[model samples]
Target: MVKLDGISSFVAIAEAGSISAAARRLHLSKSVVSERLAELEQHLGAPLFHRTTRKLSLTEDGSAFLERANRIVWEVQDAVAEVAERRGSLSGPMRLSAPVTFGRMHLGPALYPFLARHPGISLTLELDDRRIDAAAEGYDAVIRHGTVEDSRLVALPLAPSRRLLVAAPDYLARHGRPDSLAALRQHRAIYYTNRNVADWRFADVRQDVFVRPPAALRVNNGDMMRDAALAGLGLALLPSFIVGEELRAGKLVRLDIGHEAAQELIYVAHPEGRRASHKLRTLVSTLREHFGTPPYWDVV
Candidate 1:
């Protein structure tokens, strides 16, 4: 029989793309990982990897076996988790990813309390703005903004995120307030470069409007955009979660151009077909409870 440890090492090596990297991820010595791989290959009478000086890749047999290997590992883990749950506790690794701003400002706080409640749970959180392949990256869950397009994942809504057109009082004083969509197009705007930087979309009861405003600054980060707006650089279109505190504190004022900016939902998503471990379910529940319906940040 193939040992589970050998199979796990194979999966790790395949995902990580290198033996040294896999060894580091598994917290095992390179020799130990190599030994496991060698033993598994001997048992199967087939080599699993295409070893090279510059790169490592899976062989045809390895490619064919990968999906089944992943399923086996997950099944074993889920089985262990179910047993642990019946004992009134959970124990496992939970890997997650979220946008940098949300992770720092909100998700960190929400997760820490959950971690405190379940000390046996090992957590790995990656904060990045770029889109990721959830299963390929080995993340148990990912927090996403806007719509989830991948049908292979299950999205659980955490909160409603509404975008608002906003500016500092000082900026309005200098540039004058824009009362209509036409007037708003004439003002300097801070552009979030990650999205379409040239166009701003708005909707009213009767119609939708799109405007192209001259950019005063283009930035990739939401926190920086919020800061630029606060510094009276220019108008900014930002999500409520990022600027809600500033809006409430009178540092930033929402612009009413007779149309509302687009709205989206925050979601905690996981792979579709896999059975969610008890710890993952518990984390999702904690996040849902913490964010509430409208989210604490959006409460007026």
Candidate 2:
């Protein structure tokens, strides 16, 4: 029989990405964690992770083991929770991944109260602009912007978020706003580098199409673009959620052409066909209820 305690250590390492991180999460010493992983590999006669100077990544074997290990860990947790809930307690760790700006400006602030409500539930939230492989990375949930691309995940729309093209009031006052997509060609623009800077899409009642705008500056950070636009650098096409405050506060002005602005739906996503836990279900439902009908952005 495989030692379940040793399996827990492996799963922790895989989820945390390093021995030190896993050790910290599990409240174990690094040397002990390392030794346990070595023992597991020795017992299985196969390596689970490829170790390097900085971090660890799962080998093909490790990937397979992680999938099984995640199941085992969850099963054990569920079993314990089921027995404990008779005494009235809901508790476990939840790992979440999200885009940096959205997490920082939106979800981070929103989650504080949720955390306060459920003090027993531990949460590890990672914020990054790059997309993460949630299942492979062992993330419990992911909050993302834009249309859902991967159908393998169960995507639940939490709020109505949109993107808009805007420039500072000063920039608009100086250069004047473009009245058509054709007019945008001559204007300098700021863009999120991770997105296709050269090709942009616009849609409205009159026109729905893509435009290739000339890019003057490309940056991956929304905060940077916000700053650049505020400094009178160029027109920026940004997510409405990030710029909603500035737009409402008169620092930025929306450039509305006839039927050119488009809106995107945001979602909380997880792997499809899996039995989502009450914790995930609760958060998803709470967000949906909190932001229904144009979300908090429309409030101001």
Candidate 3:
């Protein structure tokens, strides 16, 4: 009989690309993971991976086995979740990833109450700005802002995020406020390098415009961009969640350039093939409820 533990370890190894990565995800020693894989391979009388000094690649058999392995692991999780649901309790680990700024400012606070309600569930939250392969990384859910084009994943919309051109009152006083998109191009702009498009795009009923102002400062994080704008460094195109409070308090002023800035949707996504456990569903619902229609951050 194939041991379920061996099958699970195989699935983790296949998805994670390396045993070391899989070990980290599974919270197991490398030796233990290796042993499990070796045992499984022996039972099947076939090598699962082509080992190399640089990397590990799945063998033909390993490639064929991965889909079935994922199904088996998901089915087991669902079985356990079914029983837990009947008992009115949730127990297991939920691994999640989100952008560093949003995770720290919003997602963390939103998750606290959910954690409080389900004391039986263990939580692992990773705050990262880079896009992640959720299945390979073994995340239960990934909170992302922007377009989710991965058809392999099921995306559940959390909230709407809009970007606005903003600057501090002092900065505007020093540099003069931009009355039009043309005037905006002459001023120093704070550029967020992490986004795919360097140019800012805006649209209205009448027309669409793209602006690429000269960069006074280039930053990878939204909070830093907001800070630069707050410190009178330069005008920044920043998301509402980052600058909404400052905008409301008059610390930062929004530029009315006729066209509305780009809007992106925030989503909590998981692999489509992965079965949603009771805990995962409840957490998604909790986040949606917590953020509300316009999101608490966008009230301004």
Candidate 4:
């Protein structure tokens, strides 16, 4: 295989206009640069330069090869930068995907400080409610909720996904709040369409219980669901982070159910072997730090 060193030397010599000039720029002896050029030319079976004391210029084959050589050199430099970023100092673009609701409510606040701290990194945040293939979709990392089924991904837990059954005070007054799990059947439901089929799960002492509430209105986004609850449409099970502000403002009321709500897991997933990248590691750490144990949003 033709070595990258030779290709890089060829590119430098072509750009610098002579092996001697390239040697000066590279801090190498002219002889070494000439030898590298000769080796590359030998490997390709072509004379890359029209050499004379007066001037140096590229031949036809050399012109075509120079383009590829330049690209190769650039690729080599980029690879070095990528490795360097993973080792310590951070730079380059970081592509991240996340669920719309959690990202806006939680990750959005945390990201500002992280970006401020690392000015070298350019971040792209893509928000989608549907689960995407992290590797196939070309994301550096993704924020996901509940059980991470993709064994190909490495996960870092960000927070506990605690959902609250809530409704507007007007709805509760008009419809009457259910005091227990069984009473939920009597309530009209505003469903988050993205939720699991056996959606409502709760804790009853050491065991678990599941309920599928009948849906009066179904929507894909959490913010819309929160709006529905605030509009007094019906009772909805919403993640704490999305409804924290509404709950705190007394626009929505959390029912004191007889059993504990089952907790789900929130994770940041990356393609396997990607956890070591400084960009991914730093982002995950920042999110973990922001969320903490019970998470600030869940305190209410």
**Per-residue CA lDDT of candidate 1, range 109-197, in tens?**
99999999899999989998877778766778889887677899998888888889999999999989998878977799898776644
Ranking by TM-score: 3, 1, 2, 4
Span of ten consecutive residues with least summed lDDT in model 1: 198-207
Model 2 residue 273 lDDT score: 48
Top candidate (lDDT):
3
CA RMSD, predictions in order:
2.4, 3.3, 1.9, 12.8
Q: What's the distance in Å from true for residue 260, model 4? A: 2.3
Candidates 2 and 3 compared: the better one by lDDT is 3
Runs in model 1 lying further than 4 Å from the true structure: 196-201, 204-209
> All candidates' TM-scores?
0.91, 0.84, 0.95, 0.70
List the global CA lDDT of all models: 0.86, 0.79, 0.87, 0.81
Comparison by TM-score, 3 against 4, better one: 3
Candidate 2 wrong stretches, greater than 4 Å: 13-27, 45-66, 81-87, 197-199, 204-209
lDDT of 3 by residue, 79-176 (tens): 88888889999988888999999998999899998899889899999998878889877888899987777887999899998888999999999989
Query: Which consecutive 10 residues in model 2 have the weakest lDDT in total?
Result: 203-212
lDDT (Cα, 0-100) at 295 in candidate 2:
81
Q: Model 1 scores what on Cα lDDT?
A: 0.86
Steric clash pairs (candidate 3):
none
lDDT of 3 at 239: 83
